[model samples]
Target: MEWIFLLLVGLAAGTLGSLVGLGGGIIVVPALIYLGSFIPGLDNLSPQVAVGTSLIVVIFTGLSSTLAYMKHKTVDYKSGLIFFIGSGPGSIIGAFINKSMNVQSFSLYFGLFMILVSIILMVRGKIKPLKLRSKYNYMRNYTNENGLETSYGFNPFVALPISFVVGLISGLFGVGGGSLMVPAMILLFMFPPHIAVATSMFMIFLSAVTSSVAHISLGNVHWLLTLVLVPGAWFGGAFGAKINTRLKGHTVITLLRVILIIIGLRLIYQGLT
Candidate 1:
């Protein structure tokens, strides 16, 4: 029963995470902690272990989503790589910080972060993309299936620092960091929504690798649980990406915003209690 529950959670997390480029860790980490409170086998689960295990699952989710998105030709590989240059070191720092957090504190901070993510989602659409003129900016163009061409660009100096902060949040919380990165890409860098999501997933895969290594070195992962979650996450990620190609994602984002708010409030209450 517990295995089944976990499998379903993994599937849901991966699907939603992949669909939005948020990386499934946002769902997985919270679910693990919630399950730990009452489930017999998971009663001893710690925040660090939950985070570590979630990061492992995120690796598979990111990989699966990135592969699926590749078929759509939406991922910006060069930008993803450049973002990783900053995110990689930031992830290492976040992982080290995670090692020192207690459950209540971790819950409190993570809940706050979730609220922030929800707020970002709420306001993301209202903020128009900015056009900046910089010699250091790298510009690219994309054409949709409808043959409509759009262009976007960003300065590396600005993008690298933003990605670093995204990576730090991801490492600290075992999330994919897409909630932050996707918004930054869209609002600050003028990336199309689809491109931002696809690129974010690509970066998530890279950052997850580095963060997972740090957690592994700290002995924070639950090997059995991680193994159980991987298969579901992998399949769900593929499924979500397929859906993404067909959907505009507004409805899903709306639902996700509400869900995050509820979860954030619940976690915050738990932490306070």
Candidate 2:
């Protein structure tokens, strides 16, 4: 039954994570917390362990999503690489910080923050667009694996800082940072929607790997739980990618906002109680 719980959590998290360029942590953490109440032996599951395990699960989901994006030639490898410049170290920092946090307070605050983030994302789309400012003087263009072309006029100064913050949040929360990264790429960098989502998946892969190592060293990971969750996450990611290709970008965004709202509220409730 615990295994079943893990599987269901993985499936739900993976599907939405892949679709929206989020790592499964956003879903996985809350799910695990909730699961602990009913599952034998899992009732003692700590938030740190849940987060560490979620990151491990994200690795599989990230890979599945990245592969699908690769086939579509939607992922911009250059962007992913650049984003990693900031994300890599930020993840490490997040892991270290997580060690010192008071779990209950962290959950409450993080939940509220997530809700705020979701609301911002929800409304940011409807607003008159803000100017895309790059600290760098010019935009760069690249072609993907299948010769699809896209351009980014970003100021690494600006972009990298945002990514670093995203990475920090990811590392702190074990969320893989996709939820924030995709939107930043689109809203801040003016990246094409498909490209942002694809690139974010690749970035998630990189960040998850780094974060996983950090968590492992910290003794936060639950390897057995990771094993149980991975298979379902992989399946969900693959299916979500397939769905991604079929649906419009706006559809993905719409779905993301709803999920974020639901998940965010749940987190808030969990925190308060």
Candidate 3:
């Protein structure tokens, strides 16, 4: 029965995660929190286990999404590599922070923190039509099938800081970091939503890999369940990448905001009760 719960959570989270560029960790972490409370011996370790397991699952989802984006030439590998150069070390620092923090405090603040971040992104995301005041006008030149390319000009100044922040969050929370990275790329870098999404997945793959390794070193992983979740998440990721081509940027952002709000409220309610 418990195993059934795990499997169902994996299936539902994987499908939705792939569809939303979340890498499934957002869903998996909350579900673990909700379920672990009911298990006699599982409560104490649930969050760590959840984070570790989700990263393992994300590894598969990220790999599949990367392949799909590569097939379409949608990924900006150069920019992603540059971002990872900063993110890799940030993730390690974040892991140390997570290790020292108290879980109770983390849980109490997690949803509220994410909600605030989501609101900022939601408001900023509405500025799609506004002209960017950037020195690099070249970011407006590249074109995709949907014309979602960033101008050819790259800005490491903004990208570097954003990458470091997102990596810290990824390592701390076991999130895909897409929620932060995608929005940062769009607003700060003035990257098109499509390009932002693809690039986020690339960064997430690196973050997940590094974070997972650190978690594993601490003996936090659930190998059996990770195996079950990975294969399914891979397929789901491919499906999401394909569907993203069909969705409009505004529509995707609207939907993502709604989902985050709902999750945020749920977490707040849980914490309060």
Candidate 4:
């Protein structure tokens, strides 16, 4: 019965996670913790265990999301490849650090990180199109029959380094990495917001798989939970891809920022109390 319950939770988490580009961890971690608190037998595992387990399930979530994005050519392969170059090593280092930390410490730092991200998002909201109109103005111009028109390029050079940091955060928190990566691609890399989300999903797919493998070798994965979660993740990802086609770039960014703020506040409350 308890296993059945966990499977249901996984399904719901995956659906919401993919829809919002949150990755399953944001939803799955809280769901597991809630269930653990209420269920007697399963409560024996520590909070860290719950977090680790949720992280493992997110591997499926990322892959499923990535596949959906790939069908539309939303993923920018060059950017993903460069970001992977830096992030792959960084993930291992972050995981090692996670293994050594205490649960309370982890919670504290995680909350702090969430808050920091929230602040950045808020600030990003206020920054007008200044940069976009400046040296990176190439996004606003292009060549056509009339001589020139605005063209948006998924330039890799601008997207890579920031994406690496986003990946590092993924390793640290066991997230899909899309939360950070998508925003960076939009704000820093100058990709269209929908494209950024799709590309981030792809990057998350690779990074999550790499991190999950590392977690497995270190004895941090929960296979039972993962099996329960993947199906939902797949379907949710496909749905999200469908939704992305209709949303305008700025609207997606705005929605994502709002969700991030809400999640950040929740994490802060959890950590403080």
The C-alpha lDDT values of all candidates are: 0.92, 0.80, 0.71, 0.63
Q: What is the C-alpha RMSD of each candidate to the true structure, in Å?
A: 1.1, 2.7, 3.2, 4.7
For model 3, the local distance difference test gives 0.71
Segments in model 4 whose C-alpha atoms lie over 4 Å from true places = 1-5, 116-160, 248-273
Which tens-of-lDDT digit does each residue in 1-273 have in candidate 2? 678878988997888888878877888887777787887788888777877888899889999989988888788788789889999999889888888866577678678766866776676556432467545634767675467776666678877998898889878887878767777777777777677878888898899899889989989898888888899999988887878777855666667677767877777776778
User: At residue 177, what lDDT does model 2 achieve?
Assistant: 83
lDDT of 3 by residue, 41-96 (tens): 66776567777777888777777888887887778887788889878777766666
Q: What TM-score would each prediction reach against the true structure?
A: 0.97, 0.89, 0.84, 0.77
What order do candidates take by TM-score, descending?
A: 1, 2, 3, 4
Q: What are the per-residue Cα lDDT tens digits for candidate 1 across 163-267?
A: 999899878999999999999999989999989999999999999999999999999899998988998999999988998999878898899889899999988
Candidate 2 has which clashing residue pairs, if any? Answer: 135-155, 136-155, 139-153
- Candidate ranking under lDDT, highest first, comes to 1, 2, 3, 4
Better of 1 and 4 by TM-score: 1
Angstrom error of the Cα, residue 241, model 1: value is 0.8
Error of 2 at 104 (Å): 1.2
Better-scoring candidate (lDDT), 2 or 3: 2
For model 2, what is the alpha-carbon lDDT of residue 41?
Answer: 83
| Candidate closest to the true structure, highest TM-score | 1
